[model samples]
Target: MEETYLLNVEGVKKKILHGGQGELPKLQDGSKFTFHFQTLKDDFERTVIDDSREAGMPMEIIVGKMFKLEIWETLLSSMRIGEVAEFWCDAIHTGMYALVSRGMRRIAEGRDPLEGQKHRCGMGNMFDYHSTGYEDLDELQRTPQPLIFIMELFRVEDPSAYKRDTWAMSKEEKLAAVPVLHSEGNRLVLRREFAQAAAKYQEAVICLRNLQAKEKPWEDGWLKLESLVTPLVLNYCQCQLELGEYYEVLEHTTELLQKHNDNAKAYFKRAKAHAAVWNEREAREDFQRVAHLDPSMAAAVKKELKQLGERMRKKHVEDRKRYQGLFQSSQG
Candidate 1:
């Protein structure tokens, strides 16, 4: 197919590798488009940078959501479903590619995509952080250039087709939803519905995190949001503990303690998780830390330590019996 310039979209040229069915669908606000994309350098080598296919999931972007790579929405809107096309976007349109790629990579790794982001624009962040944590993206950030995008439009869904995720909500909407979610979570907890309660707490935490990501990290705004996140996280950890997800409890509590080492509740929760996981030494250490941090928790810590000791003793006896039985059986 001959290369074509998108109408009124300067600095971008498109060529359809494979024609798609029907005309371009209505790309309305809140419409979701799912597509697999490969980002390549414009050089002869066409060095690959990012591939949603390699990430094992197609990318989904909502229309008119102020996505980082606005050019992508423009490129996708020009195509039909099942279309495979390549677009060469000029440096201006591709400037935010590195930032978008970093978030995509983090998502592929099962991490918080907004974990390291700050209240800065794409270019501002590129200059501030000096790296996307990926070598290729860093080079692109260092020297801006045009890029080639090979995209396959797989599916399109209207806004009403699915529930909106926290990321899809407006800032005001997200902020409004958090307290409602928190209350529902509390209600669920009262009903002993731990798993459902955990989901609510997690959703609220995600909403807060989404808000916090828009603020400079460790600043007053971010710290204030983080303070709100703490209680929700602790509540989530409590549910996980009740659900016997000891490892998850350990992970959450450890992360919490890393930021606030003096949080007695975190240390206590972590101590309980450690005890459940049979890490006697670690459990004892955390329990001691809890006692030191909050004198009021001393009695509770002592009780936990005694229970831990009893459980350990019981486990030892069980192990001894099993080993003795094995030895006897082998001799026989």
Candidate 2:
């Protein structure tokens, strides 16, 4: 049945294309939905704005959170799994979506959505004429245009699925989570769970990276985030070293050092990686750099140098013995 109006909310219309399976999932508090959505301008052919299917990643949203450009939640609440529906929403419902779409588009283009401006809430910024830097978004904001949303329901998770993990967090939640994940990684390191520790730190890095994507590079805020990410990255490097992922440690530490030459811990971790990979001269240079950056590490660097020398000498002796034995057998 095509509803002329939503159950409670007015000025919205819903048309069910394909009825879903089983009972409709309740989309009240703590319920989550994973679905693909396509937003379009209500033209003769419905011009495309964004398509989750084209992105190849379905959006998972916590119902009733109202944390995004969400006019579809009310329509989704009445939906069943595997259901397909199209909604025609008025400017009242889609206004916020236009603003949010700007940021998402900016992120897609590798540009900062929050660039060239001070902090403003999404609703407050929606009225600003500065625009979302997207032509389609600008047009939507200029006039009260209705939006066509075609959604395909995927899965619904109950409150038990709300573990508050990385993949299931909003931008604000993600920002708050960075520190918690960093600390968890630190604790895991003390337990010598290198793989697990690396996972935590990696999650932390991803959180910061997502948040940083909205800030203009080389700006004060961006630089501040870079400063914060440096230590977390070096911590991950330490874990990678313990896991014998020497190349990863070297790659990450080298990138860190390029941006931050004064990071002594990065140098030390990289030195360890170089030693593991048998890059003798590079390891020596990094050890020396660490000592120069932080003299307190001199003793530790010396100890590592001793260990590396022992390993290299033992390998050379073994190779020489093997070669000599082969030569003698051939002559005989």
Candidate 3:
């Protein structure tokens, strides 16, 4: 007679093996397998994926049962008596198996199966497969596996190396000095060092812009670093604004706003810069966008907007009166 047993992957204790009759399976070095399993419960009613198939075997009968477990049948079948298998499953499923193997780790653990499971299957939920066993219900309650897949796939890289490399440079070391100089420039600005800050911010912007321009579009890190430019440019514009360089503010802020129109603070600041230069029309437009992008700031920006309107009306009337006087003088 053929015998069967279950094998649980390491760090995935909630799952247990049910098919090894004699010896456990051996895992190859650095090899891993990914598979799905079914759990069985008292009210387990198998949903026949195929209606014509008869279900009498434990594997078939328990296939649709509700329970939480991860089993490695292939590893079990391949075992040569002294092999170890290891893999990871998340906490919820792992917890379920832990409860089963450890005999209900908590007495207060809910009997509903879905109570503690963070992942679940339903029409709207992730991993919403139809239930087969009580354990499966627990699996359903847990978050979907696909979401985990995506999270792992798009994991962010650590920036520690970049920070370290940028910080360890002498003034004369052009290769490593730029970021440090930029940092010093920022520090000077914080100390009310407008001139020093502008110099530093300019150096950093030039360095980054040069690097971006030299980078081949298809290079791996090029695109990633290119995304840094917009923020740096915005910072440059802010430095200019702080130094009361309205013309420079106009130049950099215009570019920054063009690239990042969604930033309400940028629009508000640009409005101020325009007003400083007596560019009433442009300032009015920027203030309008600031209010539109952030309704809560509408009240504050409304006053400036009203003032701009009054100024425009007064200018219009003065121009009309000046033209009328010029015509009268010419006729006289």
Candidate 4:
């Protein structure tokens, strides 16, 4: 066995495996460190839970961002580039490891790491009572066990060394960026980039929702925030319609209509989804309502109703022929 020496970096223990070549450099806050990490369960070094290397990428964090395990910052702070070490992190440090690993995994897969859970208030909330809803993550939340991290120090740079995107921004920064995001989303929608457009609108919705959560519902402040979100939410629903997420369109538009009965766009969008799914009666009613609310849409509704009538007629004829064929087969 290689000589094992125990060193405490902010109460976390590290057993140096191989100290890489070159002299260590000075590290400070906002210093960027990129490295690949492998996490193992408990003292069982063979049972790997997560590995950045296997995921085909390394993780990077600005020293002060607290992006990953805080102990990671401390441990990485001590190593030079190309160094390899195994750090035994306590529950306090590894408690949020599961969530961080989830994000890292998502990034490696080219998906948004913050997908579906962007409404979380802070990193603390990631470990809060809210289960990641992922079974493995829930287990980690249930048991804050110690973990072993095998890491290779890659490179360290200053914060100014790389461009910062919206993901790296704080809450206030994100909220401030909402207008830019909304414009970008609108641009994407115009370009027919439905998926990316949906993402941008959804991110804006998340920001607005987080802001609204802080204020009482229906209050001036809350309504003001909601007003800002209405167009974005509708835009998101519009993209969902194009993406064939009909049930989602129905769900959100229904909720939207319940709150604002005169929302012609909501009625129109919902009616389109209803028509797509062959909901004739509901679609007719919604279209009628939209025509009543916004007379400008009446011509469009007329054209849609004409096409729907033809489609329904053809469908009924096809159904009758199929039934007749089945009846003859059974009789014979």
lDDT of 2 by residue, 1-332 (tens): 65667778876888899989999776556688889898988889888999877765777777766656666677788788999998988878887787777766666667886776455666666765576677777887877678888999999988676585554567777878888898899998999998998998888888887678789988988887887798889888888887889999989999989888898899999988999998989999999999999999899989999999998999899999999999999999
Q: Per-prediction RMSD in angstroms?
A: 4.7, 7.3, 19.7, 5.0
**TM-scores of the models, in the given order?**
0.72, 0.63, 0.37, 0.71
TM-score of the candidate numbered 1? 0.72
List model 3 lDDT by residue over 51-131, tens digit each: 111221111111112323433333233433222232234443333342332222222233453444333333233233243
Model 1 residue 51 CA deviation (Å) reads 3.7
- Model 4 residue runs over 4 Å out of place are 1-9, 20-33, 40-50, 54-68, 90-147, 155-167, 193-196, 210-221, 243-245, 258-261, 329-332
Rank by TM-score (best first): 1, 4, 2, 3
TM-score of candidate 3 against the unseen true structure: 0.37
The lDDT-based order of candidates, best leading, equals 1, 2, 4, 3
On a 0 to 100 scale, what is the lDDT of residue 113 in model 2?
Answer: 68
CA lDDT of each candidate? 0.91, 0.83, 0.50, 0.81
- The top-ranked prediction according to TM-score is 1
What are the per-model numbers of colliding residue pairs?
0, 0, 39, 0
TM-score of candidate 4 on Cα atoms, chains taken together: 0.71
Score residue 7 of candidate 3 by CA lDDT: 45
Model 1 lDDT per residue over 84-188, tens place: 999999999987787888888998999987777666776677777756788998888777799999999999999889777888988888888889999999999
